[model samples]
Target chain A: MMSVGELLSQFGDKYLQALWTTYGLTVLCFAGALVLGIAITVMRICPIKPLQWFGDFYVQIFRNIPGAALLIVLVYALPYLRVMLSYYMCVLVAVTLIPSSFCSEYLMAGMNTIGAGQIEAARSLGMTFFQIVKNVVLPQALRSTVLQMTNLLVATMLTTALASQVPLNPADLTGIVTYINTHAVGGITAFMISAFFYAVTAVVIGQIGNRIDKKVRILR
Target chain B: MNGAHASIRDVLYDAPGPKAKRRIAFVTVISLLALAALLAAIVRRFYVTGQLDPKYWSIFLRYTTWRFIGRGLLGTLQVAAASSVLAFAAGMLLMMARVCRYRVLNAIATFIIELSRGIPTLLFIYFFFLLAPQFGLQLPSFWRITLPVSISAMGVTAEALRSGVNAVPRGQTEAAVSLGMRSASVFFKIVFPQGFRYVIPTLISEMVIVFKDTTYAYVVNYADLMQNAKVLISNYDALLAVYLVVAVIYIVINYLINKLAATVERRTRAAVAAAK
Candidate 1:
């Protein structure tokens, strides 16, 4: 068994790179999820019945599908359809799709909290449809969902661990741990290092989210 | 829709006037066509790639295939059920520790909860799978998957339980205390039972999560549904069809669980309202 110092000294660079990769994937996937989530939310809340159904269906399919199954489908099954994607792309897409559904659900719950009275008031004020969404709907929804989005961000990071399932050039944090474990007997120390990074990031995100929520929380 | 229960979807737009109604109708038709076109394109791809061939899907008709999958599903259910029970027990203990008078216990509980919640389940599985064996702790493949899945769910379950406990009114505790009940007795007798009722829905949703995590049973070489699907795929030479069916099975099961949670939630809420 290697000492923690020896492991760090030997593979510190790999760990750093892996951590960076994890961060990059988490941020990119989160951005992608937010964009898709907002679009789905728009579709779900739109007056068009078909679009609403599509959005609802999308959420149900993605949200309930296990991450492993979704990733396997993307990585293995898609090639059968002649739609091959890079390993990184498959991981990105899988993580993004799952979290986007959750993102939309949280946004819907946030929007629901705003209640109908506010929308009615906005309508009475002669605000245009776009204006209500822009000025009234989005601000409250986004504000109230800060905590959820934070949790989602952590969840997205955790989901990015699915990257270890596939081969990639520069693997994410979890992948790096697997790399170390396989190449050498990294043991609990290697796992703990990765877990520590995740825990710190989660705590920091939670703290920031609480601060924002405290500041912007709408008192009803 | 009733105003009291109107969600953002219902209230986002006003009751449409003639002009708005016409515009909405036009857009609906356009979107419907767009969705249908998307669906057709997917089916077309499946056709072009020979994925629509009966050879790939015919394996599903065999009774043995379903039995194999059913056996795998039983494995999955067993893991999920075992892990859920373990997680709930640990979670409740963690919750009690956190709310206890001992500061050290509270801090330890909080730290464990945060670490458990923050770290991914795969890492936990790896710890048991790769790390434990290093120290001469050999667990069965089932435990390798089940233990990690349960541990991964523990923090969230603890938080959920704590939330439920908080939702139990302060007056209940005070009243119990006034009746000369010990603090532990008050918590056990008057408080926790109500708290447990309030969080049954949350706990059920947690089960859905645990169920999903069990899919990683493949890593530990456990023959859960996905693993069984792999076996069927190998035998039939149908990877896409088998995996797709397996994925649908998972999604449908999780969906049903979620619906059950929502129903339980509503029923409990109504019960609470009636009591009030």
Candidate 2:
């Protein structure tokens, strides 16, 4: 068994870099997914028939495929279409789009729970459709679905590990583990360190989400 | 109230006038055309690259290809099935332990659940894969994937089962105990069955998640579907075709599982209503 000090001295820098990549990718993906999710939610709920069908189709297709497979497809398939992107960018696009589908569903459920009277009131006030959605609907919808959205965020964070599969930019923790396993003497110790980082981050995120949930919860 | 109020449909937007309808139709058509053009360009690229070559796809028709796919599919299914069953049992045990009267056991269960849930599934697999060799455990590669998948899944499964058990009415358990039933009997005979009924749909969906997660076995060089597809991709250089087929298989399997879950859920609801 490697001592804790020995483990840190040997693999600390790589583990730290991996931690940074994991959190950085998580933040980027979460933000991108939120924006895309809101658009998808709007498309699904808006009065446009074509948009609604498109949103439904998007959710059905993306949500059904496993994230790892989807990542593989995007990484390999995009170049064929003459669309070039770095491995990081490819991962960004795939991770963002995949979880956005679920996030949109959760947001739509929240939107559905908003009273029709609220929309009616906004309409009576001569609010435009976009205005009503932006001002009146979105805030309430988000507030109600914060916990679900948080769950999606954490799941998305976890999926960032799949990005390590991309050979070009394999900086994520899982990728780092694979690297360490081959090169380092105490590979198990190094992996445990990475696991510890991930586990701690997950716990912290859950706690923060719980705190935000309590703060933002709508009063009945 | 005297005048006809606008219908709810009109509240969001006035029914599109004839001109507005025409404009919407034109925009939709243009967008569809653009999308079609993009897809055509993609197909054209494949055509030019020989990726659409019949020779490339012919590999799927060969006996060896089928054997490879069959073996990979079996491996994936075996891991998924074994992990799900083991995880379900472990989850139930953990949930039972968590809910038991013993404080220390409850704390230990909670710690395990949180630690397991907090760690990503891939990390668990990696940890076990690396750890096994160091400990001189000459286990098969399948155990490496199965053990980690099962352990990671246990966290989620236990959480689901815990919620299901908690949702059961307290009175049912109390009544079972009042009948001079032992604690285990009260739990197993009365509470667990009812709770599990409420959670069957969720458990089924969790199984689908486990099935999808079997792809992570690729990390350990396990010959699951994804790993097999990777090998084929390298061998044939038909990356797009190989991935597309893999994605389609996954989508079809998941779609079927979802439909099954929905049907089971409806049947369970109907059964409950009938019992009432």
Candidate 3:
């Protein structure tokens, strides 16, 4: 993974490991975002308008604000308010809240597409509200939104790489490049390293997304 | 029983089902449960680290990170503004080329769009940043590094504009051409006015992305929020508190912007579509 020149050896796992830390932070942040995004989306679709507004506002801000700026507010400003979270936590928080807006929008559209006749039929049978939704509507909605959700999820994964800008240690594959770059310091080597890692990740995620999407569409 | 039948809406995609309330409730429950689990895990991770000291939080607040945040914000805005305009212009030019009788212009526009659409945006910018430095033509840093950020922004803005321009129909151009109008005026008067509406939501989304992308500056070690957060995280390891704050703020800002976009999308959709 390394040439181990004097400069590279000096930093050792220092730079490389930092890249790993970046990976960890990124994964955690997106994972959090995926979950939170789903939840906010659900809230938006619920029967309550108040909860919907709450969800809407959550999505709007997360969607609007710059990721870095948001990260700053979390990292630097919160402590001022006595609600300080760590940098890792801050990145996760930002990613989760922001991405949720996207997920909810996608999901709501899916929910909205379900035919009204089915619901009325279930109501005619006097089925419980939760049972009718779970057994009937969601299955249909899920079918329609599956391809879309897959795309959004993959896009979210790639976008989450932005977490690296929190100055990800550039370890892992990018670490090798980061290693070379710091040695070359201000050289294209670092850029190339990150680009390579990003490409690999993007391709992998894109392929997975495409495959799942294709499968979903086929059945649909 | 008589009230059971209500007037059905004409919109094709509007309704879910009659048991809408029940379905919504189910979705709500499942969503909350999952979110709760994620929050719990983060909390667990937070407590495991055991560095929730107020002294550290205080020290963290008093750091130079605030200055970096301000500067980083400015950098983010600069890139968003510049690239958005550039992207729109580029998109329009490309759109016109796509619609033009000239094969050469159409080919060029198609090539540009394909080249951009195929690549991961970050990779594009990373490469662009390298090349921009070579030419000494990039977004300059007024408060921070300008060139890198702007190039990245331009790439995305360009994509948005392409779509905007395409939304215009051939009829408008044909009418303009019949009036003996030149290509440039047709674009400015007929195509642009109509196309720019489509670009609005996309432009807003691009702006959000650009702002988010300012975090990319951290890769170059330019001080931005994400970069600062990482530094602080390692320096203090207050991962939870920091992330919670970051998530809330990002959500808050993005929420406002998207709301405006949604409002515009609704109004425009009604005004533009119904008129037809």
Off by over 4 Å in 3: A1-39, A48-65, A69-97, A139-151, A163-176, A184-220, B1-76, B91-140, B143-145, B170-188, B215-253
Alpha carbon deviation, residue A73, candidate 3 (Å): 7.4
Q: lDDT order of candidates, best first?
A: 1, 2, 3
Per-residue error (Å), model 1, residue B274: 1.9
| Residue B156 C-alpha lDDT in model 1 | 99
TM-score of structure candidate 3? 0.62
Q: Write the per-residue lDDT of candidate 3 for residues A1-220, one digit (tens) a residue.
A: 2333544465556656654664565566556765676667555544544565567667666556655556566666556455768555666676666566666666556655556777777767876545665676556655666656655554554454444444443433333443454455535544554554544554566567677666654242
What TM-score, over all chains together, does every model reach?
0.98, 0.89, 0.62
TM-score of B-chain for each predicted structure, in order: 0.97, 0.86, 0.69
- Indicate whether candidate 1 or candidate 3 has the larger lDDT: 1
| Tens digit per residue, CA lDDT, model 1, B214-253 | 9999999999999999899889999999999999999999
Q: Pick the candidate with the highest DockQ.
A: 1
What is the lDDT for A113 in model 3?
A: 57
